[model samples]
Target: MASDQSTNPPIMEAKTRHPLHQIADTPTHKLLLKQWLKEEELILSRVSHKESQIDSVRREITQLYIFFFLFHSISLLLLFHASSSSSPSSASASSACKRSWIPSLCALLSSLGIIWAVRYKSEVESHLEKLLEREKEDAKLLRKCVEELKKKGIEFDLLKEVDALRRAKSLRVESKPVRKWSARDFVTLFFFSVSCLVLAMIRLILCD
Candidate 1:
């Protein structure tokens, strides 16, 4: 009777942990830690490449936007001048109106070009920002893994993979061009711009 009484100490059963928790608590931690380090390194490389691309795109957009903005502004000024020059007192009001319409149409065309440029600029900026965000997330994940690795007393070599990945990334960056443009495309754009200006001038003279 004493065995079943308060004199006997109760046996406690051990609590069971989930498999995922078990893995985190064991050798799997080392593997996961290594993966995070590698992931961070890969992300760093990818982000660097993306940043270079963004920079190149930004330069192009900035230069084009300035040209587009000035073109539209000039078109507007020409339209205003043409309109103001037309007077009700003058019998040539009809001719003035015709000339004004030509510049006004050119102004509309230039404005549309500006709108397209802005849209493309916004898209490039958005893409660049996404790359930056992904890089930040990778960094956060790497930090988490490093803290876990430190707790487990893992070797420093596990972290060296990041440096290797970064070095590889640097190699790729070095190989990339600051700008890439074809001679044919440049010639085409130049000719097209000149044609547009010439056409605009022709219209102004003919309509007048």
Candidate 2:
């Protein structure tokens, strides 16, 4: 009886173990984890690309606005000198009036242009800020996913953090070193200033 019992297979044991054994080596849980990783990757990619685009647009808008401001500023200054030295005895009143009115018109137009540009730039900046925040949130989520995968005894790419670190390092490396101003640079600036002064004097005398 003892020998027969030892030789017999327990029927319930095989049934109970089959399902668990099938899943233990290659679990459905891991597949779910992999799927989650893919989703996270997709989200991260979308957000990052959106952030890059926003940054590019913001840069362009800022450059254009700055250009507009500088151009108008110079025009206003030149007009001021022309208006200052013009006198009834020295120049025709009609021409002086025209010159004065032209500068004023330019001033008004430039003011309006600046206002519009600033409003547009502000809107774009706000959108870019929101995108930056969204990217930050996505980064946090990616970090959490990596941690959870670690807890699950799973391995996944942690390339994002590595890439971020590399970017920071590259930025540090690419920073320009400030050099002492050379004599040539000083001479160039001096000549430019003198030229501007000469032009201003000429305009003043001719307008007068």
C-alpha local distance difference test of each model: 0.59, 0.56
Error of 2 at 206 (Å): 13
Flag regions of model 2 displaced more than 4 Å: 1-27, 77-91, 153-208
Best by lDDT: 1
TM-scores, all candidates, are: 0.48, 0.49
For each candidate, how many residue pairs have backbone atoms clashing (under 3 Å)?
0, 0
lDDT of 2: 0.56
**Which regions of candidate 1 are displaced past 4 Å?**
1-33, 73-93, 154-208
Please, what's the RMSD in Å of model 2? 11.4
Q: In candidate 1, where is summed lDDT lowest over 10 consecutive residues?
A: 10-19
Please give the distance, in angstroms, between residue 6's alpha carbon in candidate 1 and its true position after superposition.
Answer: 39
